[model samples]
Target: MKIKFRVILSISIIAVTTLMFVSCASDPDSSGLEYMPDMYRSPAIEPYVDYGEVRGRENKDLKLKRSAMIPPSGTIPYYGTDSATVALMMPYARKANVAMKSTHGMYDAVLTKENEYDFALADKNPLKLTSDNMGDLFDTGKKLFTANCAHCHGAKGNGNGPMVVSGAYVGVPDYANLTNLSDGQIFYSIYYGKGMMGAHNSLLDKREIWTLVHYIRKFQDTDYGTSQSAKALEAN
Candidate 1:
C-alpha cells in the first residue's frame, strides 16, 4: 500500500511540473495590445492650437471702410533754453568797445588794418550778399546800410557820402567799380573797413552786414537818380 501511494504522489507531482513549464513558455500573442480590435486603435494625436488669448491679431467677421487703427506710441517731450543771449548782446555792444580792443571781435578788426584782409571772417553770414530774394533782402540791406554804412561808405556806396563830404573820412570804395570785387571781398571790406574807415564789425551783426551788402549790389544795377526822382514825385 505504501509503494502504491508513493507512485500516485510521484505521478501527481510530475503532472503539476509539466503544466507549470508549459505556462512559462514564450507566449505567441498574449500581450494586451495583440487582442485589441482595429476600432480600439487610438486616433492620430493632433497638435494643440490654442488661439483664444493671443495678442497683436484679431480673427473677426466684419466689413468696413479702409482705414488704419494703429494707436501711436507716446512721444518724448522736447525742451530748449536760449543761452545765446551773451553771443547776441555782445555783438551789439562790441562797436563802442573798439577803443580798448583795437580789433572788434566781429568785422571791425578789418577796419584797423588795410590790404591785409581776413576773408574767412568776412565771408561769414554777417555778409551774405549772395542770398537776396525778390529784392526784399536787398531792401532790408539798403535800409540798414543807409542807417549804418552810409556815414562813410556813402548812401550810394560811392565813398562820397556826408561823412566823406565833410572830410571826416577818405578812401571809401566805389561800389559801381565793385564789379571786379567778389561778394566775399566786398563783405570783407565792409566788415573790417578799409583805408580811413573803422570796423563796422562792432556796430553791426553778421546778418545786418550781409543785408547791407545785398542792398549795395542793387545800387550797382539801379539808377539811383531815377529812383530819387520817382520818390520825390510820389512825395508831392
Candidate 2:
C-alpha cells in the first residue's frame, strides 16, 4: 500500500510541473494562459495609453478614435457656488481680435472685428486680494505657478525659465516689464495663451487663473496686497 501511494504522489508532482512549464510558454500575443486575466490589464484609465486589447481579445472599438476634439459652442462649465467666485469665473465679455483668428488660432472662438487686446487692458481682476485671504491665495498661486508657469516663466517671473535658458523656447516676457498690463489683459493672455503659448484654459480653471493674476502682481511689486494704494494702481 505504501509503494502504491508514493507512486501516485510522484506522478502528481510531475504532472503539475509539466503544466507549469506549458503555462509559462504561452504564445506572445496570448493572455488566455494567464491565471487571472483581469490583473493583466490596468483597471484605471491612463492618458495616451492604449486599451484596445485585453485577455488576448482585440477590440477595434476600444482604439482611440481621436486624440482630441474641440468642445461644442454656447456651453459653459459649472464653476460651483459662491456668487463672487462664479461671477469672477464667468466668460470674458470681450472677444478675441479678428487678426488673432489666424495668428492665435481663434477660428472656433468668437472673434471680434476689431483688435480686442487693447480693450482687454481696461478689464480688472475680479478675484480681489483681501488682507484675510491674501496669504492663502499666494500660496495656492505659487503651487499652481510651479506646476504650470515655472517651466516657461521662471520661479522669479524673470522670463529666464529653464526652457528659455536651455534654448528650447523664446519670447517669454519678464513680469516686471509687464507692469503696464492690466489684470484682465494678463488673464486674457493666460486663458488664451499669447505669442508662442497655446491656450491654457483647458488646463487651468478661471479661479486659478485669477489667483495667478494676483501672484503676477506680486512679481512686479513685492508689497502687493499690503496697501490700498497698490490696489488702486492695479485696478484698471
Best by TM-score: 2
- Tens digit of per-residue lDDT, candidate 1, span 1-236: 99999999999999989867655637655323323343443344223432322232443432232234333433222323443423322332112223324433432221223233433333333332222243566677777887877887787678788988998777777888875555556656666665456566657766566566556656776632234544223212
lDDT of 2: 0.81
The C-alpha RMSD in Å for every predicted model, in order, reads: 32.5, 4.9
Residues 1-236, model 2: lDDT tens digits:
99999999999999999888888755677654678765876777656556676566787987764424445777666878878867877776778777777877777778778756778887777777776888999999999999999999999999989999999999999999998888878988988778898777778988899899999988988878786555535542
Alpha-carbon local distance difference test for all models: 0.53, 0.81
lDDT, residue 105, candidate 2:
74
Q: Which residue pairs overlap in candidate 2's backbone?
A: none
What's the residue-level lDDT of 164 in candidate 1?
83
Off by over 4 Å in 1: 1-132, 223-236
